[model samples]
Target: MSLDVVVEHSVSLGRLWSEDGLDIMIAPTSVVVADALITWNVNLQWVCDLDYVPDQERPLDLVAFAAPCLWRRRMIAALVAAGREHRVALSSHSVTALQAAIENGLGIGLLPPESVRTGSMRVLKTSAGVPEPLTVQYGLYAHDRRTPVVDAAIDVLLKDIPATPGP
Candidate 1:
């Protein structure tokens, strides 16, 4: 038996899991389906680069994840609430690509702080005219079609993956 891991849009992951194309999926709670057995995970608070100050006078250039990624909606909604006009300067499915774009000063992105690699990247605070992003609930999902190997894999993952962040 072999194991494969894929990272993509949550909805695609959920669809694959429902079809048995994937044995397990770790995705946002919004994608959870009726057939899936879900274990509640952590809430991911998204932040942007510290230098990302929303300019109300101009259209905000955005670095974002491509479509089917539900998290992108949260970013857009937050921008709307802040009354900032926005345009997507760059979009990618890979977090790495998005991070690179942000680092290069292409545009502002609502990113997971954990994904920030460069020292130049700092957390943009709401005080800095940046909108406060919504916290997304993420979880591990599996279905009844699991094999013994799949079950064992799930056990190992649940045991290793922390349900909450460390202090």
Candidate 2:
């Protein structure tokens, strides 16, 4: 239940993260550790402060989440390979606290497509209009095909959150 940054980015070991080489990995996901799997058409809004605006009138900041799992770890590795890791901070803080911080101008946050809200935050345009998205293509894999919990978890994920397009 942690992030696996730099895992299998340079080369694939096809083993558990607990194995000799993969130990350095095993990072968990959050707004602090890794890049999120955004849509290819993701329109990132710059989460900033509304200092001059009234508190009661200020808009809510966007927030999103991703559970820690094997497929997610591979995604982090892919991000590292593409040189897009750490685009924003991901931490263990509560979502409300994180969103408030962003609303207070801590910095921009990359939210999932469904969480996007363009009220107060202004969109950031890449050189090509849309910024590149974090990789989200892998599923679960283990040192041995007979691994128990991993496959079951993967099965659950397969049914829970199917990867979708950005808003």
Residue by residue across 1-167, what tens digits does model 1's lDDT show? 78778977888887786677777778876776553344444433433455655565778788889986787788888878887688989999988898888877777787765677547676666665667756776777677667899898887877866565311
Tens-place lDDT per residue, model 2, 1-167, is 55344533212333334344432322222211223232222232333344412122332222222334333344344435644433333432344554565565654444444543445444343331223544333222223333455555544544654444312
lDDT of candidate 1? 0.71
Q: Model 2: how large is the Cα RMSD against the reference?
A: 11.4
Pairs that collide, model 1: none
Clashes of each: 0, 9
Candidate 2 residue-wise lDDT at 12: 38
Off by over 4 Å in 1: 35-53, 164-167
